[model samples]
Structure formats: structure tokens, C-alpha cells
Target: MKNTILIGACLLFAQQLVKAQSSSYKPVEGKIMTEWAAQVTPENVHREYPRPQMTRENWVNLNGLWNYAIRSKGQAVPTSYDGEILVPFAVESALSGVGKTVGKDNELWYNTTFSTPKKSRNDKVILHFGASDWETEVFVNGQSVGKHKGGYDPFDFDITDHLKSGKSQSLQVRVWDPSDEGPQPRGKQVNNPHGIWYTPVTGIWQTVWLETVPEVYISGLRNASDIKSKRILVTPEVAGIVDGQQVKVSAWKDGNMIAEQTVNPAEMAKLTIKDAELWAPGNPVLYDLKVELLDGKKVVDAVGSYAALREISMAADENGIQRMMLNGEFLFQYGPLDQGWFPDGLYTAPSHEALVFDIQKTQDMGFNMIRKHVKVEPATWYHACDKMGMLVWQDMPSGDMGNGWEMKVGVLGNQSDRDRTPESEAIFREEWKEVMDDFYNFPSIVVWVPFNEAWGQFKTKEITEWTMTHDPSRLVNSASGGNFEMEGTKITGDIIDLHNYPDAKMPDPEIFGKDNILVLGEYGGLGLPVDGHVWQQKDNWGYQSFKNQDELYARYAGLIEHLGKLVEAGLSAAIYTQTTDVEVETNGLMTYDRKVIKFDVSKMKSLHSPLYNK
Candidate 1:
């Protein structure tokens, strides 16, 4: 049996080191530097736009450098600053300019100075953290104002009271991440980085900024598309507002208004377009939209955002095989295994454009789908996939496989694969539900994969059924690989799936449901690109790496063509190894930095065109 307790500690280290910057970003081996290096400077650390859903000309970019130091587990802030670190990257990340680690016995601390916008006396200021891993405690101007948990979701704190009012202010963050130490939604991270597991991010891994809102402001917004009705439902999260307040929604395309509607906050606000344009990978037409709160007649508060009209489902092919359907047609969903990591940003892409490039390359490769494996992406990622017509199969990030070869994936693999204390089994089941609820709102996501190779899997029948009941619209993959047998066939499975690597073998047609799509959950990790472009200079590898771009292109062309032959065998979709190089994993079609494409774009797209009709 594998010592999972040791594995948990290793997961945390994996996340920090996975930033994988070879030369300038090397770790200090065993030395522990708690303070972030002050070289990059906080003012220039992360200077990009915070929100991509909507744009406003007046907002400020609060990403840059900050003073950081890692304190002992129960210690307070250090008396002196050791160095400067990048604001957004965690202290453990080399890109953070800190290149440090705060192990299980430490707390990462960050502090920055900022001046408020010259606002009137009535305005209120609110600070937001795009995301923070594990547990976080926030303080403003020395006063402990708020704190939060949950690594993958966004949260905020109103620092108005803790502010210096008219003077320059200080904001501070104290964070503690146990990684696999506790029952949180951590994806493939271990203390000892090896094989599939990588380093852990122990602090603010996403953007940290502030936005000023009216005393009575719009707290949040939820947008859902009703494809059958050709309409949408918009709900506002408003504070200090009456229940019957009215709000207006306006749809804009390229700075022009195409549709408009007004409604009481009681029911869904419906808007229609005479000549409607829906979003897909090829066209990716997005209509810019904004919503404003109306107090009787005056515009009180507003927020900017956009959405597309799209639908995903399972449909029957002519031969009665269940197939994955997009917009009501069985288009074999083919694309790369997108791990969503970066040479610099890790979970956070270097820039928004860098994030979009991965999806663009997959589309260029003629794939309309991406299996976002064991990771939840930033909001902009799904927006790009939705616009690019790329469908997404989102997996709930699971943790630590249990003891023994069979328990390794936990109730997966051959021989029932189940081995774990009932205590651990109960924890795994609850965590799965929490992950689904956190990401249930994404429109581009069509499938929920609960267990992949049985990693930490157990009681799948109850879990899969729970997922179906929680979100019935999407398809579910009960167990991705390992231990899939004839007896436990009802263990919460909908689509029949199989895992392949480097090469894809066809699925058996008769065994697949005429209603459940036949899917190759993983395949085609063919690799090879030039030097410098490689994440690692000597040790880089793939399931099969090539010598040149032409050869790589030829192999991918031949690989997909083979899957095309399996289309008649009830096959509806397939996912390749990955979208980019992650840590020691080099199976991505593109390098980690997004600098080069291993295959010719036009040629790859042309080759992929046949899978749709196949």
C-alpha cells in the first residue's frame, strides 16, 4: 500500500514547483526563504485587466509586486521585510519572484500599500480576490476585516471601514494551505512530485484587486440560456435593494445595440433577436451585454457581461447508438487533454491572451472539444471555449488515491479496486458534491467525469446518481478507467468511456448505449517540438514524441483518421493527451509557454474536418 499521508505532503510541493520555470526560476533546493524577493516590484507584478467578461474604461489594475514573508504556523507578521514577490503568484512559485516555500508548519503573509480613487464621501470601496487556495484571513489598514476558504472559487471583502479613508492604505493577506492535508478540492498535487502528481500553490494563486461600488450596489449576476425557447434568464445579486426593483438588460455586438428589455426583478427578463447569432467554436460570435439596476427610474448600479445561445445533449445516431451531440447533432467531439497549467502562471495563465491561445490552437488542430482534466479553469477559459465552439468535459478535481494497487485509484482499476477506511470513503463522497456545486454554472461544460482511473474513487453509484440529480442537464462519466466490469455497470454511469494513451483503439459498438455516447475519455499524447520551446531541455517526453513538426502533423492526422473508422462503432468523442506542457508532463500539442505549435495549423484543421461526418 502507498503511504498516502506522505503523498499528501508531496502534493503541496508539486503545486509550487509545477510553475516549472527552468533557468531563472530554479528552487533553492532545501533552503526555506519565507520572504518574497522584491525584484519584480509590486507595481508591475500583474498589470492585466482583472475581469474579461466585461470591460470598463475606468477600473484600475491592482496586480503587481508586494512585500511577502512566510511565518511559522502560528506566528504573526515578521518584524522586517526580507524581500519583494509578485502579487498574484503564490510565494512558493518561482515566478512570484519569491521562489520560496511555507510548509505545513507555516503561514504565508503578504502586504501592499494602495491609495483609493478620489471618490465622493458617499462611495464605498470593496476588495476582491479572484481566488485564494485553502484558508485565508484578510486585514485592511491593520484591522482584521474578513476571511474565507475554498481555493477554486472567487470571494471578496468590503474593506471600506478598514481603509485609511483619505490617506494611503495597507492591505494584508495571511494564508494557510494544507493541500491534501485536509478535505478540500485540490487537483493532482502531492508533496513528492512525480509521474502524474505535481507541486502545490500555497497562497494567493489568482488575481487580487478592488472595485468601488455605490452604497447600494449589484452584488452578483447569473446568466443561463434556454436554447429551446431562444431566450435567457438573468438574476441579480443586489444588496440594500427592494424586492420589486426593475433592471434593464441591453445586448450589444461590436458597439451596436441589437436587443433590449426591461423587467421587474420578480421574473426572468426575456430578450430576443430577430436574426440571432449563437456562439460556437468556428464563428464564436459574442454579443456584449450589460445589466443595470433601476430604482423606480434612476440608474442605481450596473455590471457588464456577455453570454451565448448554445445547447449540448446526447442523441441517437442513425444506427441507434447513443452519441455525444452538440447543438443537436452528433459531431464527434475531438480535442486535446487540457491540463490548464503554465510555465509561469500555473493554475493562472500568464495573461488572458495566453489563456485563449491554448483553445485557439486546439481549434486550429480541428478539434471542437477539450477535456479539462482534473482542473477547473478561470472564467475566461470557458468563455473562449464557448465562443470558439469548443465543448468541454469538466472533471471534479479529486485527491489522494487510497492504499494498495487496487486502492490506489480507490474502487477503480481491475478487481473492484476498492480499499479504504469507511472514514476516508465518506470524505471523498462529500468533496465530490462540493466540487460539482462550485462549477455547475458553466454553460460550455457538457459532461461531469467523477472518477478518472478511480483516483480516490468510492461509492460511485451514490456519487454519480447525486451528480445526475444535482445537475440533470449534463452527461456523467461514472468511472473513467480501471475496474469497470459488467456487475458495477450501474455504478452511476451514463456514457460508456475508455482511456487510451498515445494511440486510440476503437470502442465496442454493441456494448455502448444507444442513448449513452461512446467516448474515448483520453488518447493521443504524441509529442515533439524543438529546443528552448521545450519546457525541459533534456528530460522532456510524451507518450510518443516526434523529431519534426511535419512528422508530428502526419502522426496526428493518421491517429484521428483511425478514430474516424471507429465512428460507425458508436464512437461519439475522443480527447487527446493535452493542450500544453505541464511540469515534467510534455504530452501537450503546444509548449508550456505558448510560443510554438508542433504541427501545421491549416493542415491539422483540414485533417480534423473529416471526423464530424464520419
Candidate 2:
């Protein structure tokens, strides 16, 4: 009888192994995957808390496999799903388990179920989406909850009222993205991807989760710091607050409490940190923050947060040229142009470790900053930048292209600003503001880029001025490598930028550096594709393709040798072509799959050490 039972169990285990090898729910074939992609499974896809800036304890991660269907636009929710798809991975990506396209003509629908979290009578359940592309509408228990229309920022819906009494509830999400057909801020995504533009990502590409909060909770928080004053501002956006309810904020360092403050919901709570440690690239000191909502003295709701007391401004260098200053000192910034894309997961990384790998690699290469070119990353990306002491230059995703301008750098363009329709203009304005507000708290972000090479640049002066005024904490690069708008004799933004390829070049300091900080927004595009580690076998090209690693490193080192001279000539910052190879652009320091680092890390670090002191 015991042998019979053992035989039956052995047969079951063998059958399961076969099923796993030929699993129907596996990543699609044909694309190069990162090391972390092999670690991904349905049970462990982006399990980390989506929001690290603002976190709560009681939450449920709604990631993993979900029933997905692509139907015609405006069609009702489908009765049957086409197949199982991995949540947070776009349908066009291989990691999604269904590499397909929805396009503008169809709507991607997702259906899932979750058990209700244990909550008290006064507890409110909130549904959160870290991010989704284009237009998204949510339905809970077959009832429409709300709709959101931004692709790059986080949004949430209060689902307490829509909850069912039973332990289980239904969640339905419908998403429609017009890609390049509409005038929305989609960075480098085109229906027919070629050259610089790549694949279209539809539906949810970020984490979706649920958290439980009290009846009156802290809905949002805005953290800002003043290095000169040695204080941090904690502004809490509270919901359902009444009389006698107050908000208390406390700061801690190295496991010890440093400061605390209490204020009303509408007022900003200020905590003064004496002898505060300024956050910089070398010493990125982050103070642990705790915010609580109090009813008189009893705490009603609380959240864990953090802050960095750092300041970004502009000042004059010894050469009488404007220089970008960090904490009142000029630091020549140099880093790669980071295009946050993956071969397996498009915009979404396969895991939290995968998302952090690029940043870590860049630091390993001895770069201090990253130019986030034309795309906004998840909040966790910025948090990683903060914790790792990396400076960030955030760019608003470019869209609504085809605006005409002169094809020249270091000079004013023949044309300036696209005459966008009222609808398109309003869409651009609203989304840019939302992106700024959502990421204003991260101390690593030192620059705000409004337009990139005039892709969809409209109302340049108005947008640049507004961004500078809205966030006085960070300098605004009005148009990076884009058309120039002059206010009499000066440029409209804080920096006068130029773009050159292959060889290192800088904005003519004698012409505009004295008034504006001079920068080479993009320069190096040295490519050397490794065998068995490229997106394709042929047509993989860079601005200057090399035959071997020796040639690439020699050219890259020569470019740095000349860039140091420009730094002495009032050049404040420079950005290389990219952090990793994307599609056929083989100009990355590392390969797209992240399996190979083209240049030696220690050698690259030694090559970049002189830029800081130059």
C-alpha cells in the first residue's frame, strides 16, 4: 500500500515538471532578456511596494497573471478573455506572456479578483495604479469607479464604497492608447517604430495594488527642504479631516529622532534639523520621516516617509560663466542619457532588482548624474537615485511631433514653437504639471527639462517660466538641444545647451556661457556590439561604430580628454548618448540585455575621475 502511494506521487511530480517546461504562461520568444528576467515568475512579478515615497502597512499587491482581452474601442467588457497575461508588463513586451499589439483601434481589458483585506467599519480601501499609458478607466464590482488620463504619473481611486460584503471582489481595467495618432506625451513610442523610436506599450505597465486607510487619512504629501535654513517642509494632503484633527510630523536620523512638529491639515508642518547633513552625491543623507493624523491626541492614521535637505541653484564660476550649483558649489556634472526601456518588458523592468541594475551600473562606471531623456520613470526609480546618491535631470516625455525647426545646434532655429491646437496644448500643460507635482519631493532631481529637441515644443517661454516659478528649487532646462528662444539678449532658461555626436562638443562659452550655464546635452554615441548579446545580428549601428572594445575605449577616452578642456572654458555639464543599447542603437556603455559591460568598470571610473575637478 505504501509503495502504491509513492508511485502515484512520483507520477504526479513528473507530470508537473513536464507542464512547467512547456508552460503556456511563459515569456514570448525572440527578444534578448536581462539576468533578472530569468528570476521572474507569475508569483513574484514586481512584488515590492509600488510606492516607496509614501507607504502604509496594510496593502495587497495585485500583480501576477490576469485575464486579458483586446476588443474594439468603445466595446463593452468582454465576456471571455483571450489569454492570461502578466500584469505590469505591457502586451507588446515578451515578458507579458502575450506579445501583441492593441493600437489605437482596440482597447485592452484586464480582469482579476482579490480578497478583501481585513478592515474595521471606518477603514477605507484604496485602489492604486503606479502608472498606465494613455487613457485608463477602472471598474470595481461592475461599477465604474473613476477614469485617469496621464501615462507617466501615479493615480488612485477610493474603492471603499464599491466593495462587496463578501470576501472576494472583481476588478476590471480598460485602457486605450492612441500611440502617435493622438497628441499625448508618449516618449519615443510610435506605431511604426524605427530609428530612435521603439515599440508601443499598451495597458498597465506598472504595479497595481490596494491599501487600506482610516476614514480620515493622509492622502498625499509634499516634502521640500531648505539647505540654508536647515529645515524641511512637510505638507500633508489630508482627506476627511474635521475640527480638532491635527497632523504631526517627525524626522529621524541613524535610528534616533532629530525633530518633530505638529500642525493643522491645511498648514505646512516645518521641522528644523540643527546641524543638518546636506544631501549630495558623496553623502546622500536621507532623514526618515513619519507623518501622523491625530484626533486631538489619539493617532488616527500614520505613514512612513523620508526627506533630503538639499538645494539646487545657479551661480557664477571663476570664468564669469553661469554654472549649475549643488548646495551653493559648482560641480561639473557628467552622466549618460538614460532611456529607461527593456527588451523583455518595454517600459517596465522585470523586477525591482532589474530596475535598480542600470542605476547601479552607471554608478559603477563613475558617473554622478543621469539625463532621463524624454521619459518619466516610476517613483521607485527616483527613490533609488536618492538612496544611491545619484543626481537626476528629469525630462517631460515628448509627444505630438512633426513640428518644424532648423536642424542646427549652437544657434537659434529658423522656426520656434509648434502651433498646437487648443486641445493638444491643454493636454501638454496639464500632464507636465502633474508630472512635476508627483516627483517634486525627490532630492536627487536637480533639473527639470520641459522640451527635448523641440519634438512637441509649444509656448516655450510660457512653459519655461512656469516651470521655473512653480518649482524654484530646481533649475529648468527650457529646451535641451532644441530651438532657442531669446528674451532680448539672454536665453529663456537657465542653461544654454547643444547636441553633438561622436566627438565631444560644448555650447560656445564665448557666445552664451556668460549668461547661461553651458552644456553639451548629448555627445558620445560610440558603439561596439558584442556577439550573441545584441537585439539583432545586423543593422545594429551607432553614431560612430567601432570594430572592437579597444577602438571604442580609445575614442571614448579621447572625447573625455577634450571635454575636460571645455569644462575649463565654462562648460557646466555633459551627457553621453545612452546608458544601454535600445533597439538598434548600439551606443550604450552596456548592452541592452545588460549581460556585458563594453568598457572596464575600474578603467571607466579612472577615466571619469578628472571631470569633477576640471
Candidate 3:
């Protein structure tokens, strides 16, 4: 009886300690924040399932207040931590509770404890990280699990053997990110915040979780559809499959099974849907997918997935100029250049709803496309785009901006690719391929922008051709508003894109449109910084600053009116300067805080309607 009382007292003390730590957690102040920041707490932060494409039932979110410490690089793990930081938010971000920078000289460490999920003997426990900046190493119960590089790709490690004999397990993570000090693909993050470059993001900036799955299970699903053939192609990646193990794939629409097929693991299961509906902007149609792994008719594992029947291609118009096609139709694409950043979270959205808000507002303003500018977003952002029918031109997060650039169009022979070191080249190749492969299944991604304005541009022909060959289903914009390399008599890639500012402009159709699609990659950065919504009180600027709402709308309408003429002259698409104000750059349709829309939504929609008619 005395031992039992002692155990109860210890449990209560532990509970009280946790409560005290959680109560001490609060977001850092002294910055412009969004409404969603108020809703964030240690218990309810980013609790949504990280992966929506391939999902299972049993999982645990590891996003909450974790013990964190910043120590010098290469130093041994410290025995004590400084304080608690909110997981999934970068250490420099306001949402992290501890808003401090861990530069190249220091390394960030995280420690947490979680209860193991209920699983059978045949189940394997897997630790998943949605994303971590630069280099990351994981330790489970003091045993080294694995290490992963690349800040934008999801990675996992099997920790079943590293588990302890109790329900509770200890997790420790070590992270090092050389924001501007190294040659990794960090997008627009600089050591010093100035001009276009914003703040640095380090350590974990995405969700980390755990899952329980069968020893031999479906590891991943590569889902793609051929709209012309009316067939959905599914390649199930099985981890450990013995003899007589096969994969069963089914396609459903409106709760009815449209097609089903069974094939050996790693073999493509083609399910043909009769009278297939093509997916496009404003009419997004999604078909559900259910995949099951069977061992001689005994189901070993199952997962839920989805796909869409769509195609993005290039075709010639009556004017002998190439145009972008969606599902074989020439619908002009127009949207904003979305720099996916937040004042509070830096690299992450405060919540999933906050991530969708920008897309939804853009849709309400009558834009059907978005150029994800030089930054790859979380998978949930792309999934939201897929469901909401938003066309995406995904950009590789830019880095290694140490290249010399000459953007003169007339002097064609002056352009050359950046000669990077062997180490730098290899890093770019590996991360770019991983980024492409990680988000390849999302249908919303139509165009792949490999280089933006010569930032880390290298091996132009080789990289462009590889991207084209890697994913033949989508068009590759070799370098958006960057140095263009000539191939024989034609341009290197499928599109010839130009960047203009403060006014509407298009690529010269008479010179290059016959062989490539002409597009205005960026233009119209009309700025109106709201009084209380600006990131900074003074010195905020845009491509063209406006006085009030009326003036901003009038100037934007004029740009739209001129863009319609470019559409008729063979411009296939156009992306405005940005979606929201970022830092001191106040050239957004909405303020940095997202509290005010510079123009009326209905009026902006009406103004943009005419450009689509052509």
C-alpha cells in the first residue's frame, strides 16, 4: 500500500510538470501576425494528417512543445535544454515561442517523448518527417535511427528495432541548416534580411509523426492518369513482399467502383474508366483510389489514395504561335506569383486553413493558376490545390545565388550556365530530383520551373532535358525569367517566359512563339500597404506604390485590359508579381497580415474575365 501511494504521487508530479511547461508556451511578440496565430496552441498546432495522398488509420502526431537547445556546431549533445519550442515552426519564426536564429555556427537539438501506438506483432513502427531543413539526424532511445538531407522532401525511417520495452519512447533530433552559408536549395532565405530575401528558417519547419504498419506493407503509391487513354496507372511500392503477394487497385467515382485491377508488386496496375471526366481548373474532378496488398488473398495492408485524369501540353494556334493547353483546350492561365511565407510561421502556415486561405482568395479574385515562386510548399497545400481546381506552376526552391547574370534578351550569345563545384552540382541534382519525385502524384502541378532568374542556374540544356524526360506528362519551363539557352534554332525548353513589372507585358510572339509558348511569367506588382497591415511601419515599397483602393484598382484594371491584347497576340499565361505582401515588399493583392484585400473580389473577377475569353 505504501508503494502504490508513492507511485501515484510520482504520476501526479509528472502531470503537473507537463502542465507547467505547456502553460509557459506562448508565441513570440513584436511582429505583424495573422488571425490564425491566435488559434495556435501546443495541443492543437498542425494536428491534421500530414500526408493526404497515401493515408492509413493508425498514426500519432508529434507536433507540440518539445525541449530544444542551441549549441555550437559539432558539440556533443547537451544534457540540459534551454526551453520548450513549438514543433513544426522554425526556430527564427514568431510561432516557435523561442524566436532566435541558429546560424551556421550552431546546431539545433530537439527532445520529446511519445507513447507507442497499439499494434500487432507483425507491425513495424515507422517515424516520418514531412520536412526538415538542410541536414537532420534522428535518435530513438539513444540509438541512431538515420540521417536525411534536403529541406523540402519527406523522409522516413523504421524505428521498430530501436524501440524500448515500455509504452513511452524517447526521441532526439539534431539539425543543421546553412541558410546562406551553404549551397543547398534554400529559397529566398538569407543571413541578412534585405530587398527580396527574407528571414532565415532553420531546424524542423514541418510536421513529424509516427505510423504503425504491417511488416510487409504498401510503402508508397505512384498514381497518374492518361486522359487520352481513359486509364489510371497505379504503381504500388511494396516494402517486403514474398511469393504470391499481389497488389489490388480500385478506382471509384461518387462512391461507385469504376475500375479495378490486380497486379504483382511494383508492376503498373492500369484501370480504365469508361467515359472518363477530365480534370481542369474550376471543374476539378477527382477519382478515389483504394490499394490493397494481398498475400494469396489474405490482405496484408491497405491504403487510401486518389488521382485525376488530366493533361498539360503545348499546341500551335491559328497565328502559327504555340499556346499552353489544358486537357487539349487553350484556356489562358492567369494567377499571382505566390511566395509561400508567413510573418509568424516563416516557412509554415499557422494552420491548414491558413494555407488554403490564400488559394481560396485567389480563386475568389478570378485567378485559376498560381506560380509557386521559388519555394515548394507542404503536401497539404498541393492537395488543397488539387481539390479546389487550382492550376499550379511549381518552382524549385532557389539557392546558390552566387552566379553572374546578364538578362539582356537581344544579346543571345552572352548567356551561360553557372559553373558550380562538383559538390554544389551534386547537391542540386539530388534535391531537385527528390522534389520532383516527391510531388509528382499531385495533379494540380502542371508546369515545373527549374530555375528562376538565374539563381543557381547550371547545365541549362542537360537539366532542362532531364526534367522533360523525367516527367513527360507536364511541360517544363527551363528557366522562368532567367537566362535562356538556344537549342539549334529554337529555345531550350517548351516555354519562352519573360518578366515585366508595373505594367502588362508578353514575350515577343513574332520572334519565338512559333517554336515555344509565350508567357509573361511575372508582371503587375501594384502595391497598396494598409495602415495597420503592413509588415513594417515605414520604408515599405512595391513595383509601383498606390495611394488608395480606388487608384490601385484602376491601375490593376488597366494592366488587365492590356494583358487581354497580349493573349490575342499569343501569350498563353501570365503571373502577377505576388499573392500577398512579403516583408518590406508591399506589392501584393492582400496585405502581409492578410487582414485587408486591396481590391473588391467581385470587381477584380469581372476585370479578369475578358482575358480568359481569348
Candidate 4:
């Protein structure tokens, strides 16, 4: 009875501590927020697993309230934190509970305590970060573990040596992001938010977790599918590999093992899938993968993954016009320009369901593809696309400005290239390569867009050729509506793309048909501002604004009708303005809150069906 009373008192004390930590923090006043914002709490923040492509059974979610401090750069860690900030949400976001800005002059520090999971003698504790903005340095148990310098990539550090023998461990992270002031690929983040730019995101903006692995285990897996050859290439990168370590791979379909192969850790394993079903927008068939690391006859490590077999290429149709071929057939791709922003969370979605909701809604609206504009999303976004049968046109976020945009409506125009500093160029190249390699396994990505609308575009020919050579499997759009650096009157890349606002328009087939696939990269930004659902009540605008839903629907239908005509004129694909209203941009299919879908889903789907069928 005495012990039970003591336990109750301790539980009450803990609850009071949590309440006290959250009491001082509150979301900023007078800004639009989503339904998910109210549902966010420290106990249930980002409870889902971080990585979908690579799955492990044992893992710990380190997402919740973490002690945060803002101090000037180069200053030592503060003895005490100002308040509790939610993990995986930027400090500048309302969801974080500390809506404070951490500029370049200051560093954002995060400190959290986690109980160590049960481990075997040979087990290694690995700490993983889904993503953080700009530059980040990590410390475990007061010892510096490692540092990473990419805002949009997942990275990990082996914390086995840093963990002290104890039930509880200390984890600390220090971050510095210059936003627009620095020459990093920040997308639309600006220190001063206005016009196309929004608030800055600092510190961790995605999931943070820990996993235990054996000393000799699979470090990484790169799955490349060759539909033409009917083979799946599995490259297994192993850590702590011994001389006799062997890796076994098996492919499963419908819970039945159809193919298996065993190879050395250093060699690539090719599994030939007989009668394999191809993956496409209409039919996204995925095969289950199981990998086992064996030491002699005993299994040392194992992981579960999945992949799909699909092919993307460009070829001339019967009319001698270039068309985008999916699995050796022409399929017209039509979808929205997904900017991937949220009112409450900025770059980070409020929940995994929220992240998947956008893609599912896009699919329900009958769109076949989504051009992720000027930003790279978490791997879960791509995984959602892969599972839901959505094709993705991934963009490399632009950086290092000073290039003037040349809107070449019909006549040829010349735009000067921005001569970037050596450091800036190296930063762009390294991050771009890392982004590609990290996201290469996802089957939904079909196109790689290096530059968008000449924002920091430089050495177009060299960059295009390098991207093409780096990944020959995918088509490269050198620039989307960007300045075309011509080599004797021909565009450098695979697709000739154009941007026209508030209506349907395409590049002339007579000019680009023989050499490149013509596409309307951006168009149709029809906006309708629903009261109580906008980022701001006043000054909310789109490319074109409408007073009512009927007007918006009528204009959208007309655009689709005109787009069909362009498709007949050799336009292979088209991307509309956006998926959701962001900031002051009210030209989205849905409102910023995601509560009101501006269009009728069934009618939109029906209208889009004829375009693919034709």
C-alpha cells in the first residue's frame, strides 16, 4: 500500500512537470493553422516509423518535447534551456510550441534524454535524423558524434562508442541555418517572408530515431529495376564485413518466394523475376524483398524492403513527335505543382497521415503525376507516391541567385548565367549528388529537374550532361521553364518545357517536336478564396482569382478542354499550378487548411480520364 501511494505521487509529479514545460510555450497568434495542429502533443508527435523503404523491427522513436536553447553562434551550450520545443518541428513553426526565429547570428540547440534499448554484446546503436535544415552537429553523452550539412537528406551516426553504460542517455544537437542569406538550396525559405518566400525552418524538421544493429549488418541497399531485362539489381553495402560473410536476397510476390540469390558482400546480386508485373500509374505492383546477412550458417542481420519494376523513356510516336513512354507506351501525364508546404508546420507535415493525405488526394483527383516544385520532400513522400501509383518529377531546389529569368514566349531570348563562387558551386554539386543517390531507389521518380526557371542556373550544358550521365535510367529536364542554353538551336535536355499562367499553353511542337518531348511544365493557377480558410484574410491572391466555386470550376474545366487540344498537338504532359494554397497563394485545388477541397473530386477525375485515354 505504501509503495503504491509513492508510485502515484511520482506519476503525478511527472505529469505536472510536463504541464509546466508546455505552459510557457504557445503557438503564435493570428495565423491560419490546420486541423492537425490541435492534435499535436509531445506524447504522440511523429510516432510513425521514420524510414519506409528500409525496415527494421527494433527501433526507438525519439520524438517528443526536447529542451531547446537559442544562443549566439560560437557560444557554449547553455546551462539551462529557455523552454521545451517539440522535436522534428522547426523552431519557427507554430507546431513546435516555440514560435521563435533562430537566425544566422544564433545557433539552435536541442537536448533530449532517452532510455537506451536492450542490446546484445555485438549490437551497435545507430542514431538517425530524417532531416535538418542547413548544417547540424550532434553530440552524444557530451562527446561530438558527427556533423552533417544537408537540409533535405537523411543521415546517421553510429553512437555505439558514445553511449555510456546506463539506462538513460543524453543527446544534443546544434544547428545553424542562414536561410536565404546563405547560398544553400533553401527552396523558398527566407529570413524575411514576403511574396513567393515563406518563413525559415531551422533545426530538425523530420523524425529522429535510434536503431540497434549487429556489428556485421547491412548498411544500405540500392534497388535498381530493369524491366526490359526482367532483372532487379540489388547492391548491398555491408558494415563490419568479414572475409567469409555472405548476403542472401529473396524476392517475394503474394507471400510466395519466387526468386532467391546468395552472393558475397562486395558483389551485386541480380535476381531475375520471372513473369514480373510492371509498375505504372494505373497498376503499381510492388515486390517484397528480404535480405539476410549470414556468417557461415548463422544469420547475422536481416532487413525487409520493397521495390517496383517500371521504365521511363522518350520515343517518337507514329506521328513522328516525341512522347514520354511509360513501360514502352505513351501515357499522358497530368498533375499539379506540389509545393509541399503547411500552414502550421512549414516544411514538416503535422503527421504521417497528413503527408500521405496530400498524395492520396492527388490520386483521387485523377492526376497521374506530381511535379514536386523547387523542394525535396522526406522519403516517406516518395514512398507514398510509389505505393499509391503516382509518378513524381523531383526538382533540385535552386540556390545562389543573380540569374535573370528570360521568359521566351516565342522569340529566342538570351539570359546571362550566374557565375557562382567556387564554394557555392561545390555546395550545390555535392548536395545534388547526395540527394539523387539517396532517393534513387524509389520507383515513382521518372524525371530529374536540375534547375527551375533560371533561379541560380549556371553552366547549363555541363550540369545537364553530368546529371544525364550520373543516372542514365531517368530523363533529365535541364531546366523547367528556365533559360534554354542552345547548342546550335537545340535545347540541352530531354524535355522542352514552358510555363504559362492561369491557362493552358504548351511549347510549339513544330519547334521542339523532332528533338525533345514538349510539355506544359506549369499552368492553370485558377484561385478561389474561401472565407475562413485562407492564410490571410486580405491580400491573398493567385495567378487569377475567382469569386465563387462555380466560376472556378468553369474556368478549370475550360483549361482542361484547351489542354486536351494541346495534347493532340504533341504536348506529352502538363502540370497545373499547385496542390494546395501556400502562404498568400490562394490558387490551389484545395484551401490552405486542407478542410475544403475546392473542386469536386468525382467530376475532376472524370474530366481527367479522357486525357489519358485519348
lDDT of each: 0.69, 0.90, 0.90, 0.89
Return the TM-score for candidate 2, rounded to 2 decimals: 0.96
TM-score-wise, the better of 1 and 4 is 4
**What lDDT tens digits, residue by residue, belong to model 2 across residues 1-614?**
99999999999999897567446578999989998888888878899877888889999999988899999999997899998899999999999999999999999999999998799999999999988998999999999999999799889999999998898999999999999998999999999987788999888999999999999899999999878789999999999988889999999998999999999997888899987999999899999999999997899999999999998888887778899999999899999999999999999999889899999999989999999988888889999999999999999999999886665644544466888999988888898999999999899999999998889999899999999999988999988885978865478989887877878887677778778988889888998888888888988889989999999999999999999998888888999998999988889999999999999999999999999997
Give residue 540's error in model 4 in angstroms: 1.3
Identify the superior model by TM-score, candidate 1 or candidate 3.
Answer: 3
Q: What is the TM-score of each candidate against the true structure?
A: 0.84, 0.96, 0.97, 0.97
lDDT (tens digit, per residue) of candidate 4 on 152-218: 8889999999889879999889999988889888888888887677889999999999999998889
Query: lDDT score, residue 365, model 2?
Result: 92
> Candidate 3 at 571: error in angstroms?
0.2
In Å, residue 412's CA in model 3 sits off its true spot by 7.2
What is the per-residue lDDT of model 3 for residues 293-353, given as tens digits with 9 covering 90 to 100?
A: 9988799999999999999999998889999999998999999999999999999999999
Residue range with the least summed lDDT across 10 consecutive positions in model 3: 406-415
Candidate 1 residue-wise lDDT, 1-614, digit = tens: 37897898799778655433222333223322212222333344456655655444455556766677877888775566766666677676656767666767788888887877666576677787777876889888778888776676667787777767566887778898877665555787666656566778788877787777778777666566666767655665676777667878887778888777887664456767546766555666566678888987888878787767766677777787777766676677887788887655556665566678788778777888888888777666777676667788888777656622242232234545456567655655655665565455456778898777766666666777788888777788776654453443333467767676767764466544554567787878877745765545667677887888778877887887788888767788888888877776666777666666667778778888888877
Comparing 3 and 4 on lDDT, the stronger one? 3
Q: What are the C-alpha RMSDs, in order, of all predicted structures?
A: 10.2, 3.1, 2.3, 1.7
